[model samples]
Target: MRETLRVQLWPLPTLGVALAAVAGVGLPQLDARIQLDPPTWLKTYLFSGGPDAARSVLSAIAGSLVTVTALTFSLTVLTLQLASSQFSPRLLRTFTADRHVQATLALFLTTFTFALTVLRTVRTGKDEQTEFVPQISVTVALLLTLASLLALVLFLSHLARELRIETMMRSVHSATVHTIHRLLPQQQDTAGRDSAAGNASGATPEPPANALPLTVSASGFLTSMDEKALLRAAVEADAVVLIDRTPGDSLVAGTPVGVAWPRPGTHLSSEARARLVGRAAAAVSIGPERTDREDVAFGIRQLTDIATKALSPGINDPTTAVHALAHSSALLCELAGRDLGPRMLHDDQQRLRVVLRRPDLDELVTLAVAQPLRYGAGEPAVLARIAALLRELAWTAPPDRHPPIAGALARLRSTIDGQDLDDTEHVRLVELTRLAEEALAGRWPPGR
Candidate 1:
């Protein structure tokens, strides 16, 4: 339920439909109330009219709205298709996460709903009975229709802007940085006070030989799990639990995704172990594909895919590859300065309640840009950009963190040594490589 709401596909549209229904049902009462007791002040704004004019306007709105809604849906889907084919299919996740597109659909539906509902409230001259019209409701419906049309125009303009590669890159960049900040804990929390306490006290223990193995039955990406709930369940059962699968891990049926061991010398019965695994599994959520909501590696994968596509022989777009490396390098550099958060979490009684698995800084750097490095080494533009990136990281990160990025830079240098580039081109790349070496060595440039 929580994951569904967090990654809601049509959340805004669903609410808009409900709100339109409410407006359709309630606005007519407002008209009736006005007619029953006309406020002298509000009378000037009150619509004093008949079904002849209002019904005709509403009918027009209703017809136009249907056509416009279908057109918008088609255009939006086409835009997504183009983006996926030209850029990266991984980017399709961004389109699903967009609220504006959802709002466009909602507005179109709301306009049609409001107009049709108002038309039903109005009737023309009858042969034997009386005719009535909700003048105020119909007027409001017209206003809403006009508003919807204006919104549709804006939506079209925004959709065009969104399709531009620059806008998409900016969105991807911001999301990656935000994800880093959210998922990477502060150094003090991970390796400082709490870490020292746990390390000194020998709080965390190894899993027992008889520890129960919780094989994941479902096969998919493990998107998320309720950490608190898992911890609470473990605490209640006096069990120490360690999850082998992280949010981004792919699970195969009957694979050990986690382990549960009873406290110290205690032995939990089979029924108890079975119940614990059931509760733990219930708190975990899995999906067919990765989601940005909890899958920490998804952002890196998207950026890397973009760079890989850019560097592909068919596309041959080195500048785009360089840009992607800049972002990936920045992420890795930032990560280098922070302590990778604690894997073992202890409860109030100093017993390990939950154990987490996360990628280390070296692994993250490898995952983020390794593909592009492997593919783009021959491109001078790509190598220079990455060299500059390495220089930036080498200076900003601690001394120990240099080897991971420096090692990659060394690979670049080795590749350059073997390449058949002209002397002038080779010299330029070597210069960049030299600067990177100096930065990693914590030395200033000659004059500086």
Candidate 2:
């Protein structure tokens, strides 16, 4: 019942009752004076033998009562209509949608209500016939004017703030999206181009001048060759080759591998080539085939690209890119027959182990170790040794032993005091030290 009254009948009825009570109190006195009426008691009290002031007072009171009741009823109806039309849900939503505007409106309404009460008191004097039309009109006009000014200021301020926020959000969102897009491809291309350019520069001062650029596809005899021997042969022949290994191809311990580039006008007899291939085949034990080398290489390239892009300023930490490179390096080693086994394959696991056991083997350490070696030594002897140890570890060790290997490598890094050696010599020593550590940890020796 209370809910129903609150929702349906309370507000308008209360306002009406209040208006009626006000009219009843003020109008009677004013009307009595206007109509020249007096009550019988009042006439006796003032002048016992004179005209009947009671009649004039009563007539004025009745007339004023009628006028005031009619005016109040008209005003109430008009107010309700105006409220319904101008302050409809849709219009009110638009007006009070802004917090500032809503606050200003509340202030104006409160002031107007106070002003109305003041106007009523000042205009309704003791005389029953006194008119309050001017005061009422002026009060209403003042209220409306104040409301208009408040609404205008609030609406303008709200619109300006809204526009500013929207513009800022849009600009920031666009910039972020655009930056990400631009950076992704740029990173990929940058890494690829840099690698390709580095390879093209052919800056490594290594021997073996009869090098041919050999490109081997996956479905060839190259898949069956011993990776170590192939790399050695390539180094001997001064050849640059791309080896494509199918994912999960079990590599035998000893198999002839790699595409060979014969010297110009110095083609080898098939028998001689076969002999070289057979000798090359006698090197390392192969693993169970799981993934293709080409696919692995492609994945590594993609990851490298992503990392490079993510490393851009304002995108992600540069260490992220370095970590990516480390992961790719590990994968590439495996694809190139230098696997670190399954346990060390995952970056997080590998990183955790490195952190707990070999904390010195951070991204910076890897970069410092890898950059000079990769760039300075092209097909160096130490690299071959490192590659051979990596292959041995992958074949022999369990997945969990990667941490110890990482620890060993870190130990090796610490041993290298800062010494002023030539670039090639320095890189060679670093590579040799790293390979020795890997071999010692994995219980492997040269030619094992």
Tens-digit lDDT string for candidate 2 (357-446): 001113222432343233323323323333333344434444444554455355444434344456865676576665555554564455
lDDT of 1 by residue, 122-185 (tens): 7666876457677677778777887888988999898989998767877887787787677666
**What alpha-carbon RMSD in Å does predicted model 1 have with respect to the real structure?**
2.9
After superposing candidate 1, which stretches have Cα over 4 Å from the reference?
2-9, 46-49, 189-211, 444-448
- Show how many residue pairs clash in every candidate, following the order shown: 0, 35
Worst 10 residues of 2 by lDDT: 351-360
Model 2 gets an lDDT of 0.36
TM-score of each: 0.90, 0.19
lDDT by candidate, in order shown: 0.76, 0.36
